[model samples]
Structures are given as C-alpha cells and as structure tokens.
Target: MLTPVLIVLGSYFIGGVPVAYLTGWLLRGVDIRRYGSGNVGASNVWQSISRAAVVPVGLAEIGQGLLGIVIAKAVDQGLAVQVLAGLAALAGHNWSPFLRLTGGRGVGHAIGFLLILSWPGLGAFVGLSLLGVALRAIPQFVGLGIAVAPLAALAKGQSLEIVAGSAGMAALIIAKRLLGNRLALPPGADPRRVLLNRLLYDRDTHEREAWVRRGQDE
Candidate 1:
C-alpha cells in the first residue's frame, strides 16, 4: 500500500520538473512564462527560445510521463496503479506545485503516457496531430486526434483500463487547453469567446502571430 502511494507521489514530482522553464532561464535568463504564449511547454520554448532547446525540453517532458508508468510497472503493480501513476504525472505537469499550480498544456506528457498505455492510440494521436499542423489548422486537428485516441484503443480491442486511461489523458489535455497557463482574460472581453478560442486555438486571440509575439517587446 505504501509503495503504491510513494510511486504515485514520485511520478508527480518527476512530471513537475519544469524542464521548459529551466531551459528558458538557462539559455536566455528569462522566465519562460513571461514570453511566447506564456506557456511552460515545448511549443512556447520553441517560440520563445531556440528550436534546439525544444528538442531536449520536449523529450524530457515526454520522459517524465514515460517514467511515471515505468516506475509503476517496475514495481509490478497492477494496471490500475500504473494508470493512476500516469494520470498523476499528467496532473503534475499540468499543475505543478513548483510553479504555483501553473504548468504546461500536458501534450507531451499525454504523449508519453499514451505511448505506454496504447501505442495504437498514441500513433493515431501523433499522426492526426501532425496532419493538423501540416494543414495549418492545429487546434482542430489536435483536438480531433486526442478525441480519436480512446476510439482507436477501443477499435484495437485494448483493455478497458487502457481505453479509460487514454480517455483520462485526453481529458487532462482538453482541460489544460481550456484553462490555459493561468492568463486572465482581457478586460471587457467575452469570457465565453475567450474560452472558446482557448479550446479551439490554444490562445486568447485568433491571430497566431499576435498571440505568440505578445510580451516580446517587454
């Protein structure tokens, strides 16, 4: 009993490492949260810092998710515990105590968890998400890909645990997208529209360039 509890807690700390935040500070001596998109995720790292930086930070974030499952598996815990650990990791990455409950969008962490939970689902998500990027309609396609993950797992006849785990991961990602990085809506802005934009575009505004470039001059 104690072992499982420790495993879950360890997974959360692992996922809470804040690799992107450290990367930005190390490379440019700036808080990543104050820069591009104000997100402590790899995409923001890419926009705020260098493409090269994203490689390591992205891999590390994914590894955080992967390690959570690995730790649970290492202890020979059952599937439920493993799924719980994975979800814990996602929760940590999404709302790290180290960052005052602020963190990334959990896309990378979700990828990591799904990779171990169901490769077919992960493949479906990655393929479709990439397709969306290629089509210049990232939010729509990414959301579609996430939405399809559990279905893909179900189609492949994965266990109920795997399907449910995949769905849980999707829920985390969607929730983060909706909540954003704790940025407040502009004064007088329609709360509903801003939330819609966050869900659909991962930003407060529809203009990608403007959103990404915000706070750059500061």
Candidate 2:
C-alpha cells in the first residue's frame, strides 16, 4: 500500500541524514569519513573524535529507526515498516548524501531498525552482537548477527516480510563492506591476529584503534 511505500521512503530519507558526518564536521571541522575507516558511523566517530559523543550519535540513529516503526504501525500491523525501515537505515548509513555518499557499515543503524520493529528481535540481535563482539568483534560477526535477525523474528512468530527484510538488510551490510574497498585478510593471515582484532575492537584506545582501522583500510 501507499503507507508501506511512504514509510519505507521516509525511513530511508531519515536514515540518510548522516548524523555522524554532520556531527563530526560541526564539532571537529573534519569529515570523519576521510579520517578513519572511511566510515561516517559511530565507531569511526568514537575512534577519531570524542568517545563521549558516541552515545548521542547512536541514540540519534536509533531514534530515526523508531520513527520509521511509528509511521509503519500507523499504517498496518506486520513487519513491513520495521523491515523497510531497517533496509532504509542501512541504505542511509552506507550511502549517505551528507557525507558525499561515503559512510560507515551501518551496523548501528540496522540495530536501530530492529529495535523499533520488534523489541524481542532487538534483544536477540543485541545479545548476539555483544556476544560476537565480546568473543571476537570482527565486522563479519556484525554482519552475521544481522543475518540472525530473521531467525530471531521467526522465533518470535514474526511475519515473512520482516524476516526477509531483516535478512536482506544483513546481506546489504556484508555487501557494503566488501564493495567499500575494506581490506580482506589474506588466506594466510594469522588466525590469532584476526581473533585478537575482533575481541579488542570494542575497547582499544583512540591511538591504538588506528591499528585496527589500518587492517580494514588495507
């Protein structure tokens, strides 16, 4: 219906706002996309900018996703709004016009979408994501956690639209990373190093975080 279309489109535009890019530019006068991981997401902002600002940035993105769900709920009762919003947020995070189209991996944005679509779904995603990051915070697990969203939805009796939409968003996340010129490890790269990078990603200092970014940038 027109409602779904409009909700999705609205979510896309809202998600497309590029809070990180705008925030960094306003606060630091530098486009964060050019400084670290070439991403305009919260993680990059945390690395190159002030860590205190990450919460506000993440909250703003989450708010955008919640807004999408509200619009969708007004129209109908399925996962249509949530799913579309998730995808739109993903699209926005990856191809934000504000950042000259350069942006981050959209993990947070995707999480934002799920949080609004289904709280249970959001819980599942958060637990899995944190577990993955705790054990090994590889970007791949972030993608994998996204892939888990549909399954989580199923566990909660969610509709096909939600399932497929969430899965598609996950796929988009993987595709974005691969297409964005991020480094793919050589077949022979040390497994320990890979694991270490994943586990340590969430806690490294700004200066040392650059090491992780270098691996991704290469």
Candidate 3:
C-alpha cells in the first residue's frame, strides 16, 4: 500500500515538472505564463519561443505522462494502480502545484498516457485531432478526439479500467480547457461568451493571432 501511494505521489511530481515553463525561462528568460496564450505548455513554447524549443518541451511533457505509467508497471502494481498513476500524472500536468495550480491543456500528457494505456485510442484521438487542425477547427477536433477516445478503447476491447482511465483523461483535458489559466475576462466581455469561447476555441477570443500575440504586446 505504501509503495502504491508513493508511486502515485512520485508520478504527480514527475508530471508537475513544468517543462515548458523551465524551457521559456532558460531559453528566453521570461515566464511562459505571461506569453503565448498564457499557457505553460508546448504550444506556448512554440509560439512564445523558438520552434526548435517545442521539440524538447513537447517530448518532456509526454514523457512525464509516460514515465508515471512506466513506473507503476515496473512495480507490477496491477492495472488499477497503473491507471491511477496515469490519471495522477494528467492531473498533475493540468494543475501543477509548482505553478500555483496553473498548467497546460494536457494534450501532450494525454497523448503519452493514452499511448501506454491504449495505442489504438491514442491513434483515434490523434487522427481526429489532426483532422480538425487540418480543417482549421482545432478545438472542435480536439474535443471530438477526446470524446471518442473511450469508445475507441472499448472497441479495442480494452479493460474497463483502461476505458475509465481514457474517460478520466478526457475529463481532465475538458476541465482545464474550461477553467483555462483563470485569467479574468476582458473588460465588457460577457462571462457566458468568454467561457463558451474557452470551451470551444481554447481562447477568450476567436482571433488566434491576436490571442497568441497578446503577451508580446503587453
């Protein structure tokens, strides 16, 4: 019991490493949270920093999720604990304690977790998400991918625990998208519309260029 507890705790801390935040600080001497959609994630790294930086930062985020499950599996803690470890990693990445409960949207982390839990599910998510991106509707496709992940797991004949974990991943991603960085609404911005936009577009406004450049203008 103690070992499982420690594994989950360790996984959380691993996921909470804030790779993008560290990357931004090391490469540009800026707080990533203040730039590029104000997200401490790889996409922000790409937008706020050099495109080259995105590779390492993105891999690290995915590794955080992958490492958690790997550790659990190494201990032979059974599927339940493995699933818990994965979810704990996602939770940590989504609401990292090191960032004062602020963190990324968990796309990379989810990819890693799903890759280990069910590669087929991951394929479904990535395929749909990329399709949406190709169509210039990232948020919609991302949501669709997340929504379809558990069904993909079910179709692949994954265990109930794996299916639940996939659903749990979706929940965490959706929650982060809805809550965002907890930034205040723009003056005169309707609360309903802002939240709706956040849910659908992952931004407070539809202007992607403007939103990504907001930090630079600040």
Candidate 2 vs candidate 3: the lDDT winner is 3
Q: Looking at model 1, report the run of 10 residues with the lowest lDDT sum.
A: 180-189
Q: Candidate 2, which segments miss by more than 4 Å at Cα? A: 75-78, 136-140, 181-218
TM-score per prediction, in order, is: 0.96, 0.76, 0.96
Query: What is each predicted model's overall lDDT from 0 to 1?
Result: 0.87, 0.68, 0.88
**Per-residue lDDT of 1-218 in model 3, one digit per residue for the tens?**
44889988888888988999999889889999888788889989988877998988889899998887998888788898888888888889889989999999888889899989898789999999889978989878988898899999999899999999999999999989889988877779988888888888888887789888877876
Worst 10 residues of 3 by lDDT: 1-10
The CA-based lDDT of model 2 is what?
Answer: 0.68
Per-residue alpha-carbon lDDT of model 1 for 151-182, expressed as tens digits? 99999999999899889888988898889887
How far residue 164's Cα lies from its native spot in candidate 2, in Å, is 0.8
The candidate with the higher TM-score, 1 or 2, is 1
